[model samples]
Target chain A: MAGVRIALWDLPTRIVHWSLVVLIPFSWWSAENHDLERHRWSGYAILGLLVFRLIWGFVGSSTSRFASFLRGPRAVLAYARGSGDKRLGHNPMGGWSVVAMLALLVAQVGLGLFASDDDGLETGPLNHLVSYATAETLTELHELLFNVLAALIALHVATVLFYLFVRRDNLIAPMLGGSKQLDAEPAARPTMARPLRALAVAAVAFAIMAWISKGAPLAW
Target chain B: MRTRLIIGSVAAGLASVAMAQVPSVAEQVKARQAGMKSVGAAFKGLRDEMSGTPDAAAVKRHAAVLAGHSSKVGGWFGASAASAPGVTTAALPAIWTRNADFRKAASAFDVEARKTLALANAGDMAGVGGQLRALGGTCKGCHDDFKAKDD
Candidate 1:
């Protein structure tokens, strides 16, 4: 059974995850403290990570697919009932939560690109296009959603803890190590593709994200 | 025909009265120039201290100046508005269109700047730094919304 289970989260995913854990809060703190230099760099790093994760969700691995784990009502219900296979990757409901978190975070970071703290001291690069009223509204909404993200993160942590204690699942460990110890089973798996392919995908995503973030300026 | 003539006369009288009541561009310009001069001088004083060469004892005196003149700046906004009929100051149309928001920005600045001044006077560098940031935020904030961009 152990031999059958293939590596799911490749090295890039691990780097992105751990980097995000450090960068997200640091970005928030730097912005809050008016550390403009740090805030700007943190924002760029976030944009990079978000882009990488999106690409990884598509062509990276089977376990990483939106199609693989993003399931319907029955799947979620089964997951809630705790009868589903505790596979090597995200369960259905957890997959959707990941999607939601990623979407919200993307929005938060995207809006931050256009928001100004109303201080001429720190205008986002794209603030030039938006009107003052619109900019102010966006800034407020961006901040308000930060609190919402924090709540969602807390709920995520709580769920992980609950699963650990109640369901005897080591979800966090799998995230950290990219492997889960499952019960006795039959072996059947395929080899993961080359890391260079993953790196190439990441490069493409980064380029696309960079282009979109620049407002596709030449198109205008 | 007689009723029509009478109505025309009445309309003319009211029009003349309204014209008499309105202030001209020159009058408005003069008022804004005066207000800007006074406020600009006060700000210059603050800038001097903030240039990283502040005298601790002078902070108290300067705080009084900022406190006294902040209301004066608030009053100037009104006076300038009354005088300048249509010139776009950094003051947003929302100042008049959404009066509450303008007031909030102004009020917040006043409160925070005072707190900043107090912090400076106390020689609480960290507290003063935070308050200064807050004050700067409010100032830039109101201007960004209400005032026109420099362009």
Candidate 2:
């Protein structure tokens, strides 16, 4: 049962992961209580974090990059049939699920930008740019998209549990601690981008988010 | 005697048909929604106007709209309207069961709305802003118990 411990991911990835874990619930609570001010801030925070993650997917670390996990459909099929190569990172199928989750989250935040409540009293920061009819429609879609996001999150958890119990893999611990218990010590240390680089990416993400929160006007 | 009896029966049938043509619960719900939206828009408009050096006429118009809608807020909700089957609404069943409390909230809202309009008419923008906050509280108080959550 004992295994070698190997470094699996960078700290930025772990922070982004856990931030989502907190923000998702906070978003729900704010909306349920009709606290639109808090809800808007929550959406802005999510928007910033998602931007960071998307950028990190390109340039942060090896396992965090899309190139490392993504495979063609044929590879996914082979994985499903239990014949694909086993890697330390996400299996082929999980690669696409991660992409889907990120895509849905992005879409959800986009819709919230233009959404207006039934009475038009509460509105997103960008609601001023759209017609009332369009804002209302986006609001409906915003609610609907949240449900879709919820479903995907449920499936995501189910899969994680399946791996934890049936496959006897502990995926959660590695995510938290950034190290994995492996059968053998990895031969090469996975290279992490400099912390400065991550700070640069985060700065860029949150700056854009802050601008949008101010209604994304040219003058502002 | 036979002719008179026949005429009475026809009259009763016609009255029953007329009753059936009256507004259904769904219609009431729709009107209630429209009225509520109008009131909300008025409140938001007033707040926007009050944010700067307000045009007194604009403030008066917005305040009047709120006053008018708030006065009718009572008729917009009813025993038949709350949680009516096949009706889509944010109204909770508690609106009917807690009738006395709901009425009190509506009355408070109506009082604040009228006071706001009067202040606007007197060119008292200072008073209008604070009054609306009190008005907002009544709205929140009712919504907390009587309305379903937006989520």
Runs in model 1 deviating more than 4 A are A1-6, A185-187, A212-216, B1-151
- Residue-level lDDT tens digits of model 2 in A97-188: 99999999999999999876554446787876666556667888988888899999999999999999998888899899998877776666
Which runs of model 2 end up more than 4 angstroms from their true locations? A1-6, A33-40, A86-88, A114-123, A127-137, A181-189, B1-22, B44-64, B78-89, B93-100, B115-132
- Give the best candidate by DockQ: 2
Q: What tens digits encode model 1's per-residue C-alpha lDDT throughout A62-114? A: 67767776889898898888778655467878888988888888998888877
Candidate 2 per-residue lDDT over residues B43-134, each given as its tens digit: 76776676456788989998999898888887778665665567788888777888888889888889988999999999998999878668
**Residue B24 in model 2: shift from native, Å?**
3.3
Clash count (model 1, backbone only): 6
Clash-forming residue pairs, model 2 = none
